[model samples]
Target chain A: MEKEKVKLRIYGMTCDDCVSTVTAGLKKQKGVIDVKVSLKDGTGEVNINNKEVKPEELLRNEVFTRPSHYKAIIIND
Target chain B: MSEPEKFDLVIIGRGAAAFSAAIKASELSNGEMTIAMVGTGPIGGTCVNVGCVPSKYLLEASHSVFKPAHPRMPGLHETEVKYDFSKIMEGLRSYVSHARDSKYVKVIENYSNVKLFTGLGSFLDKKTVVITGPDGKEVGKVSGSNILIATGSHPSIPNIKGLSNTGFITSDTIWEMNELPESVAIIGGGAIGLEIGQALLHFGSKVIVIEAMDSILPQTEGEIREALKKELESEGMRFYLRARVSAVSRSGNWKSLDVITHKGNEKITVKEIIVATGRQPNTEYLNLERVDVKTDPRGLIITSDTMKTSASGIYAAGDCVSKNMFLETLAAREGVVAVSNIFGENIKIDYNSTTWAVFTNPQVAGVGMTEREFSKMNGSCSTRTFSLLNLTKASITGETEGLIKIVVDPKDNRIVGMQILAPNATDIITEGAYAVRNGYTIDDVISTSHIFPSFSEGVKLAAQSFIRDISKMACCVE
Candidate 1:
C-alpha cells in the first residue's frame, strides 16, 4: 500500500482532554497508521497507507467545531 | 451470504437526543432486539458534558461567591474573596463524571436488549454503521433496519481579520482554563455569550459585550430585554450595541479591538476575547450526497416535520438537522418523534410550542410566540402584560423590575404565548408552555388559582388583563 501524510486543522481542542478526544477519533479511521495532534496550533498530522483514501471521505467521519475552526489540508508527498 | 451482524436499530450519538431515543427504542422492542451506539466525548453528550450542565453549575457557584458578603453590603465595600479555579473545575468535572457513571450507565445496564459501543460511528451505507475504537482499530461494522443521526453542534467563530494572530478563545474552550481572566471582551450578545458574560462579570472581570445588533437578546420581549439590560448595566458591563468589529491584534500583553461605531472607528483593549456568535450543525460527515440526503450550503441536514431527511430509510434529528429548535429539551423531543415514526408510529414535532431561556441576571424565559413573532404571523392576536411592581412577591424579593406578558387570539380566547422576566423565569415559563401546547385559552390561565404570594401569580394577572369584564370579579381579583 502507498502511504501519504495529511494535516487536519481542528478547533475546540482547548485542553489536553480535547487533544485526547481528537487523537482517539482520528486513530479509529480504517487506514490511519500514526497520528500526532497539537492543542496550540489546532492541527493533526496523520500517516495513511490507504491509496484509495480521499479528502471528501475524511471530512465525512467525525464532527469538528465548524468549517472555520477546523479544516483538513492534504500535504504533497 | 456470511452471517449478518444483527441488530434492530443503531444510533450515532450519546447526548440527550440519542439516549432518549435509545430508551424509547429499547422499550418498543419488548427486550428482544439488539442495539448499539457510540460517543466521541465523555459518555454523556453536550448538555451533560459541557454546554449547559457544567456552565450552569459554575454560574451558580460564581453567583454565590459574588453575592454580598455581609447581610446587607450595598453600594461598594472593600472585601477579599478568592477562588481556587483548579479546585472548582475539578469539582465540576467530578460532578459531570458522577452523573454519567451513576445515572447514564445504570439506564443501559438495566435494559436487556441495549448495548453500548464507545467509539466513532460512520455510515457505510444507509443500513450499515462502522464503529472505530480508540486504538486505531475497526471494532465492528453492523447493519440495522433503521439509523438515527443525533450528533449535535459545536461553537462557530466568525472570520475576523487578524484574529488568528491575536489569539482568541470560544465558549467551548473557556472551561479548560484554570485561571480567571482579569478582563474580557465578548464578541457576541447571544444566549451563550450573555450567559458566560454574566458569569465572568460576577467572577470579577470587567466584561464588555459587543453586539452587531442594536440590543442584546434581540428576539426576546422588549420589557425583559430592557430590565435585563438595566441590571447588567448596574453590574458595570459595557455594551457596544450596533458595533461591528473590524480587526483584532495583539500589542504587548493585551488584545486590541478595532470597532466601527455610529460615530466612526474606535479601539478597545482587553486581556482576552471570546467569540460566542453561535453554533453550526454537525453534518460534515455521512456522505450525504451518496444517499441523496439534501442539506443547505452550510451543511445543515433538511428534514420534514416527521424528522425524515430527503433520503429513504434515513432519519436526522438534533442540531444536525435544519428544523432544529436548538435546546436539549427540544432535541430530546425530536428524537422521540423521529424514532416513533421510524418504528411505524406517526407523530410530528410541534415546533410552535418550544420554550427558550437565557440565564442572565433576572433571567429571560419565553414560550410560544413573542409579540414580534406574533406580529410577523399577523394572526389577529392581541398582547397584555402585568408588571412585577404589582405583585407582592416581587416587592418581598426586591425584584420589581420584571414583568409577564400573555398573548391571546381574541377570535377564540386561546392563549398563543407567554413571556416572563423574573427570578424563576425558567421554572415559571413551563406552565405557560404547557398552556400553549395543550390549547389552553386565556380564560383557563386566568381562572386557574395560584398559591398566595407566588411568582406564577403574574401569569394569572396578565391573563386577566386580556379580558374586559373586571368589575364582575371578586375583590383583589383584578
Candidate 2:
C-alpha cells in the first residue's frame, strides 16, 4: 500500500477543544494512518494508505462532516 | 476618633475597575502604597455578580437544555428536555458567588496594603470621604492623596404612567426569580433585552421584546441586527420594534401595557415585565457635587483620556465615566490606565481597539468603526461581507446563520472595522480587533495563515473577500 500525505485547510475552530475534536475525527477516518491539526495556522495534515481509501473519501467521511461544524479541504500544490 | 485613615489612593467602587486599579497600583508601588477600597455594594461588582457572568451562564444553560428539541441536524429526532427553573437559578447564584470569591475577594486577600471597607462612601470634600454603615451611621472617614471613582452603574428604569404601581423588574432583580415567568414582556430591545428574551424563550417562556427604537441593537451593524432578529424570531420570540409604552395596568396576575406603535394604540398582556432600558452612572451617590467633580447632564463623570476628572487628583473609570462602550474588560483596562497615569506615566484609553459582544445565540461582536460610523467620517472606505453559510465549519456545526463584514480603507487596504455574527463571534473578534488596531491591510490577513475550520478564519475570509471572490477561490488560496 502506498502512503500519501495530504495537507488540508480547516476552518471554524475557536479553541483547543475544537483542535482535539478535529484531530480525533480525522484519525478515526478509514485508511487515515495519522492526523495532525494546528490551531495556530488553521491547517491539518493526514497521512493515509492510498490503496485502502481515496483522499476525497476520507475528506467526505462522516467524521469530517456536518454537525461538528468543521470543514477540511485538500490543498493542491 | 482616630485620625482619618490615610492612604495613597482610595477607590470608591469594588467592581472590575476598582479591583484592577488596586492591583495595578499595588504592582506599581511594590506593596508600599496603602489603598482603601470603600464600597457598600457586592464585593465582585457587576460583571461577576449580576451583569455578564450570571447572564451568560443562564444563556448557555438555556441553550443546552433547549438543544435536544431544536437540534439543527436533519436526521436527529426532537426530544423534550425538562429543567427546574429554581435549580438553574440556584446554580447561577452559586457560580457567581464562587467566581467572586476566587476572582475578586480571594485575590484581594493577598494585597496586604489594600484595605477593604464595606460601607457607603460619599465625598466629604476634595480629599475626604465619609463612610456610612448600613444603618446610616458614620463608621469612619478616609482621605487619600489620589482618588479613583469606579462605583459603576445601575439599571435605569423609565418613567411610565402606573408602571411603578404595576411593578416590574430590572436586570438586577431578574436573578432573584425562583420560577420562570409564564410569559414576559421585555421593555427595551438592546443587548440585555434580546439576550434575556431569547434565553427565556428557550426556557419555555413566551417572550415579547418591545424596542422603542426603530430597530433592536441600534448600535450594532444593521445587517447583523436583522439577521439576529430573524433567527430569534424563528425560535418563537416576538419583537415589537418602534413601540413606546404609554402606561401599565395590572389585572389579576397579568400586566397590561398600553403601547403606541405605527399600527396604533395596543395593549400587551404578560405575566411579568423586565426593564432592559439602559444604565446610569453611580455618580449620584458619590456626591461628586461636594468635591466639585464635573459630570454630564445624565450624571456620568466626565474624565479626560487619562481618566483624570475635571478636579485635579480625582480620577474616574468604569461605567461611572463616559466611554464609547461599557464592558467589564474595558472598565478594567481603563482602571489600569488610570492608575498608570496617576503614577506619573501618561497613557490614554484607546477605544478604537476595544472589542464588544452581545452574548445572544449567534453572538454579535465588533471592533473599530461601524458602517454608519465610517460613512459619517466621509472617508474613502469600502466594505466586504462573507457569509457563515459559505464556511464549512459553520455548515458542520449547523450555525450557518451569520456573516462577517469588514470595512477597509480602499486606498491602503487597511481594515478599519470588523463585525461578526456567529456562534463564536465573541472569541474571534479579538483577531479583527488586532487587525483594526494595528492597521493591518487585507493582504496582511489573507497572507497570515488561519486555522482550518475555525471561526477566526472568517476574519481572513472577510478580508480576502475584498480583493477576490472567496466563493471562487479554493481553500487556503490567497
Which model scores highest in TM-score? Answer: 2
lDDT of 1 at B347: 82
Query: Each prediction's DockQ?
Result: 0.01, 0.01
* lDDT for each residue of candidate 1 in B265-300, tens digit (9 for 90 to 100): 889999999998888877676667776789987688
Model 1 spans with C-alpha error above 4 angstroms: A1-77, B1-4, B69-82, B132-139, B468-478
Give me the chain B TM-score of candidate 1: 0.92
Show where candidate 2 strays beyond 4 Å. Answer: A1-77
List each model's interface RMSD: 18.7, 25.5
- The 0-to-1 C-alpha lDDT of every candidate, in the order given, reads 0.76, 0.87
Error of 2 at B364 (Å): 0.7
**Which residue pairs does candidate 1 place in steric collision?**
A60-B285
